[model samples]
Target chain A: MNKKYNLAVVGTNFIVPRFIDAAERSGYFHLHSIVSRKTQSGLCFRSANGYDSDVVIHENIADMLNDDKVDVVYLASPNAIHFPQAAACIKAGKHVIVEKPMTSNTRELLSLIALAKANNVLLMDAMKSLLCPNFSILVDNLSRVGRIRQCTSTYSKISSRYQGYLDGNNPNTFNRMLSNGSVMDLGVYCIHPFVHLFGSPEQVHAYADLLDSGVDAAGIVILKYPQFHVNITHSKTCATTNSSEIQGEDGTIVIDNISTLTSLKFVDKKGEETEISAPQDPNSIFYIAQHLGETISSGLKESAVNTHALSTKVLTVLDEVRRQTGVRFPADDR
Target chain B: MNKKYNLAVVGTNFIVPRFIDAAERSGYFHLHSIVSRKTQSGLCFRSANGYDSDVVIHENIADMLNDDKVDVVYLASPNAIHFPQAAACIKAGKHVIVEKPMTSNTRELLSLIALAKANNVLLMDAMKSLLCPNFSILVDNLSRVGRIRQCTSTYSKISSRYQGYLDGNNPNTFNRMLSNGSVMDLGVYCIHPFVHLFGSPEQVHAYADLLDSGVDAAGIVILKYPQFHVNITHSKTCATTNSSEIQGEDGTIVIDNISTLTSLKFVDKKGEETEISAPQDPNSIFYIAQHLGETISSGLKESAVNTHALSTKVLTVLDEVRRQTGVRFPADDR
Candidate 1:
């Protein structure tokens, strides 16, 4: 018999409704509750998203963590709150699928991992791209390109609220106090695919154009590996073509977006183009939700795909880049 | 009356024939002579490229400079030899068109500029992209994009001889001792376009993956300006998509092959794609040759388009990037 996992979500921002849709779409998971500072909005969000009337609406993290029916906590909160909120859920013996970046720094992430392990609960960073069916095809087809030599990933979109910031309003996306910068918000998308394709880099060099708030508005990060190099560029002040290229000696892989692994094209040395697509649902989060359900049902405490070690490595690289570029958050003081 | 310029090319390599073709194609210039270490090969090259039978084949630079009929010395020498060769031509009171990476560093370039001024001869760095008619349109269209925010230029082609280097032959392109690396050979195409568009950057941060020959096999350079950032990636070990993107608040300009500037597409914020193509000769070098012809005939000591100031700025950025990445050449010591 298949076990149905009850899921609760923390944070009610633009991503919360998407999580609710993903949870409801995955047959093995139930959207049980949502934690938001505004309980009325959470209730409204649940009703709008077609969640049952019985779905719990908690006004705070404590009330949500105290709920005994929640088996997994989906965290899509601000960067600064990820650690403490995920830790509370782990301490409560709940599995977790925290959003990208997972925490502000590597240390907090490590602590959360330790707590999750002590309680024997699955803890996975929701890097939805890795769970996409096309990612495996990319990994498998890498050899066709021969030895990997160079990779470039670009993920830039003008934040809808960026104009407000340019006009002297402070938005959380550009606020260092909120632990948000171009790197934390957009760079993680570029970094994850890089770290996934190639393990930890030997060195990381980053340069940025800082916003008035002293956070990176746009930047480039160079990851040096033993034989190949990767260039990752991200920005919130501008929109990019949103294409990425991985060059190997024999062929190259062109990806349309790092956020979603939907469109892929492979060009060989002779310039023959082949489109590579995999079957998957449009909502990428649904795949991750399904993966989490299977892993927890099988009594596994970690995902083999988005492993703890990979998350740690990605966070370590991000931490060093932030340190080099002078992007500091209040949580770094601890 | 139009003054016809007689051109004498120094060094007989792959690019020498192209210069011959451009000179022949441009009605204002004549290919009068060729200089090569092996005079027989120069004779063969002149004959093969359909040069006049009367074209003089000189065995040395001094002989070519002494030919009073040679009004311009087109230098296509090895990287380490560009400084002294161009300097000799300037001292001999002849206008010169030196190939890219005009000199190993900015100091030598400045010295050549001073010499050109003292001799009152036009000196231009043969960066073909700047002379391309399409480039001017890009510069003109910059306002449509609004305030520039981020730019990326990639020019990577796997050297046909790279396999020879991997199999243990140090070709001139990979040999650090000969003042060769990915930056000098390939990155100049990326750097020249960036400098031509943005002037000089306020700061440069570079990271390279060095080969066993102690030269950068590939790298990324971040050029920081007050309001925006530019990312340049170049490689000799692998081929790239060979495209560039300049993003502004209102639109973007996509360039195909920064080396040639053949195809350009302008996309506005509304996602309307407009292809902007300018009329140019099949051989892009024809534009630079004609520009040099007009500048010299007008008694100017430098080109207003590919100015000495612009070449100096480009070399300055390249030198700093080389210094930061530890790409040392024997010429740097002198």
Candidate 2:
């Protein structure tokens, strides 16, 4: 009999359908349950994908994690809820995959990691970015640049919602209590990629433009490594950028888009450049599914790509950035 | 008889010869004196292009400004001295043309502006970018895209001297106390073009990558206006970037090099791009010299290209950015 791991997906919204699609295509995992904060979201999740009725639907984390049929918990909730939901899953003996900006702050994430380890549960930060084939290629090829002198990464999206925020119509994204600004949202993407390439920085300095609600609408952060430095910036109320560029002693490596896996190029100091492309995956969730399957099947304690420790480090940087900029979410307070 | 204005040029480094060349070429202004802080620099200034001994050499600002032979003060000193020099010139009944980052801070500039107004003397920020013919063309054609939306400007130079700073050479260009860093050095070039075209930003937020000595090695900042935003970035100890881009409601105006004032293009919403290359002058200093001649001849109270208030505004923003990033220049205390 082919072993089928039962997977439970939580918080069905902008990303949930894609996750479900990838899970369905994987065939290694059985899509078992869908959980949302409300019944309508669960129905929307089901209707959007025409999901099988065999899958359970739960409105609350306690009910969902308590269900024995669910072996893996994927908490793709709001910026504020990742920690509590993931901890609850770990306590209930389910492997956890929480979305990026894993917890509102470092302290919350540390507590969750402690609980997960104590319970012997596999906890991953669902940062599929580090797991992408293209990213792996870039990291492998980074040494071609000889020695990295500096790197600059930018991720900016022109949010229609920001226009609404300015008009006082919709303000959740601008709200400090939701951790719904550019740094926590987009800048987090820049942080992990740089951290994955060059370990935690020796010194970190950030300058964020605060919104009316005291959250960062846009921000730039510098991570000073031993040999070089990484300059990262993100803005919710702006438009596109050249993703990320790593400049070194010999050449430069540029990734067109960091938010999603895309193309990259290595340009040598002599101006010789080589392009590296990723085998296209229609759904962004493919990497996460593959990582989870490999981690479980190989009996590996955890996938190094999204290890708990790396998540903790990223969370620590986030905590310091928030402290410096004075951005806070309810979960951070918790 | 053609009215001739007498000018005193300060600082004898890279830009002094260019200013002297322009002044000598112009029939409107006669180079009266060349003041150098060091005797060696004064001799170098005299030997350059065979400048005559009649050009008075003063070692100090008080002596240069007090000299009745000098009618206008052309300051090319390090960033730290621009404020005091301009203030002293305004006090001494001479017009002033101080180099970029007009002063270290806004308060110093405000005081100078008051003094200039009281003395009925012309004061201008000698920004080559604002008066460039190519920039004027860009500004005139910017509104063709209807209403403006977004902009990204970058001015970066890979300074071998910054490497010297890393080697602990302590060059004035990398000096933290002189307000010398990537942003002030390069980003001021980026800001002049953007601000001249789009006008002052309603809000400004900066993200600076501070070097070991507390200078911004590289940084990115966003200038928020009413309808859209402008992104400005620079790095002295890093790679380079394109000059500037102004995106509008219908299209985007991309300038190949704002500093050089080279090629330009208008890309519309449907992706039709119209490239327009402006006539380039081998010597980029011609535009400023022409402006200086016209402004002085017409007895204009302020320069149209580089106005006093606009220069003051830019200095104020730089001050706030330094304050937030803890970039305390030696001049700040003075």
Predicted structure with the largest lDDT when compared to the true one: 1
Extract clashing residue pairs from model 2. A250-A269, B177-B330
Worst 10 residues of 1 chain B by lDDT: B19-28
B35-98 per-residue lDDT for model 2 (tens digits): 8888777977697658877777788888888788777878998888888788888889998888
How does chain A of every candidate compare to the true chain A by TM-score?
Answer: 0.97, 0.94
- Give candidate 1 misplaced runs (Cα > 4 Å): A167-169, B167-169
What does fnat come to for each candidate?
0.48, 0.06
Docking class of 1: medium
lDDT of 1: 0.85
lDDT score, candidate 2, position A249: 50
Candidate 2, chain A: TM-score against the reference: 0.94
